[model samples]
Target: MLAPFLIMLREGLEAALIVGIIAGYLRQTGRGHWLPAVWIGIFLAVALSLFTGAAIQLLATGFPQKAQELFEALIGLLAVAVLVGMVFWMRRVARSIRTELHASVDAALAGRDGAAWALIFMVFLATAREGLESVFFLLAIFQQSPSAAAPLGALLGLLAAVAAGWAIYAGALRLDLRRFFRWTGVFILFVAAGLLAGSLRALHEAGLWNSLQQVVFDLGRVLPESSPFGTVLSGLLGYREAPTLGEVIVYIVFLAITVPLFLRPQPAARLGRVTDV
Candidate 1:
């Protein structure tokens, strides 16, 4: 539940920020009429994202047991890849994202010929990228622990993000988005580590990975997963009371490597503050 919440919160906020930036730019440049095109593009991107997720879920349900495990394992790996890429890329691009977005919009509006198409395409691509990223990340979480709470948490996170984005756009909120993204990026790295371990477990179950099947240590008695705290741990951290040797090794190794990398600061850039200018 916590995993999906954080994932969607971060991703949703990103989409909202991008749209806000675009809309803000249009209004400031006396191109408010293009605002409707932005909304249309957002709607199209969202619809595509929903359709893709539904198709994938419906397709996955028809698979046999082992095949299903393999599919989950594959999706988990893919999600982890996307999550890691997004985290690092955001760090690198954060300082200059506004400028890049503004440039893109300017280019789109440079000529009247196909101007609407250009605007819609630009916003659609940006938003769809964020949406698809969320879909994969959330799918991996659901695969780890299927429940109503996870989806609900994600939905709420997205709603909160939209509200917060609106507030920011209206100049009613001043957020340290730099700090927010940094912290959430760290949180996501840990979550991705757990998912990586979980994926290995799934691969083992699917018979694609057979070695290291031995139980490393059993903690079922002290903290059974059926218990409340255990359930929370399992959902958030992928804590298996009696995890296999492979799972334990992957989990430990992943955090050990990624955490340090995440902590290292990037080279400073000479970018200005976030603004519609």
Candidate 2:
């Protein structure tokens, strides 16, 4: 539940931020009339995301057990890849996103011919990227944990993101986006590592991966995933009471490789920018 919540929150917030920046730029430059076009693009992008998620869910329900496992494994792998890419991409663009967005807005509105269409397409592409990322992550989470709470958490997270975005846009809130993203990026890396391990487990269950089948340790007696605390840990950190050797190894290796690179000091070229939003 917590994992889905945080993932959705981060993804939704990123989209909201993009929309806010575009809207803000348009208003600041006396192009507020373009706001309607922006809204249209957002609506279309959101519809597409919802339709895609629903279609995938319906299709997965009809698959055989092994096929289901394989599908889940594939979704988990895709989610991890998308999550990792999103974290790094945001880090790389955080410093210049505002400037780049402003420039894009200028370009979109530069031509009188189909200027509104250009702006709509620009906004659609930006928001759709974030929306599609959220859809994949949410699907992976839902597949792993089939509980009512997970969807509720995702809804809450998205609502919170919308509120936060509105507050920021209305000048009612001042958040340190740099610190927010930095810490969340670290948190997400852990989440992605867990998802990666879970994906490997899914693959093994699907009969597609059989190596490293030895059990690492049995904590089921001491900390069963069914326990309340253990469940929380599992939801947040992908904790497994009796993890296989491969799962443990992959989990550790993933963190070892990603944590340092993520925490390393940014290059000067990526620093010294106002990223308050």
Candidate 3:
């Protein structure tokens, strides 16, 4: 619960900040007329995200148990891809985000007829990227956890994210976002790795993959997944009491390769202009 909450909070806040920056810039530069386009883009992206999640949930609920497992595995795989890509993409663009936003806004407002549409597309794509990422991660989390706690955690995370974004914009929060993102990137890498392993296990259960079906280890008898601590770990890190050899291998390999790559700072990507309160 804590894991998903924090991850979503950070990711959501990042998206919110981008949108806020663009919106604020437009207002400051006497382009307040374009605000409607940005709002439209945001609403549309949100609607699309909600629709996509609902469609996926509806489809999965109709599947058999094995099929559901396979679906979950696929979702986890997708989530892992998005997670890794987001981390890398942010690392590369974090520094230039404000500049990019300004440039984009300028370009969009350069013309009259097509400006709104262009801006709409830009904002929609930006927000939707984050929305889709959130969808898959939350889906994977909810599949593993069938408790109210999961949704509650996500809601709290989202609220926190919004508040944080506002605080940062207002100079109320003096967080070093570069450092924060770096640490969260590391945490997300591990979480994604764990999800990868869980995905493999799901695939195995669905008989889609049989490459590494051997039992790597079993702790079901000693500390079952149903236990309080075990459940918490599983929810946080995709832990399994009786994980298969394939799952363990996949998890380890993902972490081994992704962690180091994620931790290295791209000095060129650090934001240069600091916002004054």
Candidate 4:
């Protein structure tokens, strides 16, 4: 629950910040007429996200046991890709996001009435990217844990995101967004690595990958996954009490590489019209 809550909170805050920035810029630039288009985009993106999730859930209900495992594995891999892409993409654009957004807005407004549709499309795509990332991450987490916790975590995450978004917009929250993204990006690398290991396990269970089916370590005697603390660690950080050598190696190597890359801050550029909070 804590894992999902934090992941969703971080992702949702990002989407909220994007929308807020676009709206704020529109208002400040005396182009508030396009605000409706932006809202329309947000609504459509949300609807699409909900529909996509429902579709996946419905499809999963009809799958056989092995098929379900395969589905879970596939979703975990996809989530890993999306999660990594999002983190790296943000790192590359942390400084230039405002300039890019302003350029997009300008381009959209300069077009004809069709420009409204373009504006909506841009906002929709931005928000949907975040939404889909959340969906996949939640699904992977849910596969490893219980269903009841996922919904609760999602709710908590949404509430936190709303409050944080409001604080950011009101200039009440003074986050070092650069550092925040960097650290969180590093944290997500671990999450993705865990998902990768879990995906491999799922594939093995489904008989899709039979090459590396050996248990490298068995700590069930000392600590079992069913234990309270073990369960907590498993759910939050994908800690396997008895892990395969492959899993441990993947997790460790992932952190070792990703942490250094994330910690190395790039030179900040002076982008135009970036509101400092």
| Residue range 1-277, candidate 3, lDDT tens digits | 8878888887888887888898889888888888999999989999999999999999899999999999999999998998999888887777678888888888877887898999999899889989988998889878878788889999999999989888876767877777777778888888888888888888888998989778878999888899999888887888889888888888888988888777764465463432321
Give residue 1's error in model 1 in angstroms: 1.9
Q: Write the per-residue lDDT of candidate 2 for residues 108-132, one digit (tens) a residue.
A: 9898999999999999999999989
Work out the TM-score per prediction: 0.96, 0.98, 0.92, 0.92
- Candidate 1 global TM-score: 0.96
Per-residue CA lDDT of model 1 for 109-216, tens digit only, reads 899899999999999999999999998888889888888889998998898888988888888988888778878988888888888998998998898999998998
lDDT of 4 by residue, 1-277 (tens): 7778878888988898899889989999998988999989999988988888889978998999999999999998998888888888877776678777888888888868698899999999989989888888887788878658767987899889989988997778877776677677777887788888888888878889777456788878777888877776777667887777767776778778776776675654633222342
- Judged by whole-model lDDT over C-alpha atoms, candidate 2 comes out at 0.90
* Candidate 4 stretches greater than 4 Å from native: 267-277
Better of 3 and 4 by lDDT: 3
Give lDDT per model, in order.
0.88, 0.90, 0.84, 0.81
Candidate 1 vs candidate 4: which has greater lDDT? 1
- Supply candidate 1's per-residue lDDT for 60: 97
Instruction: Name the weakest run of 10 consecutive residues (lDDT summed) in model 2.
Output: 268-277
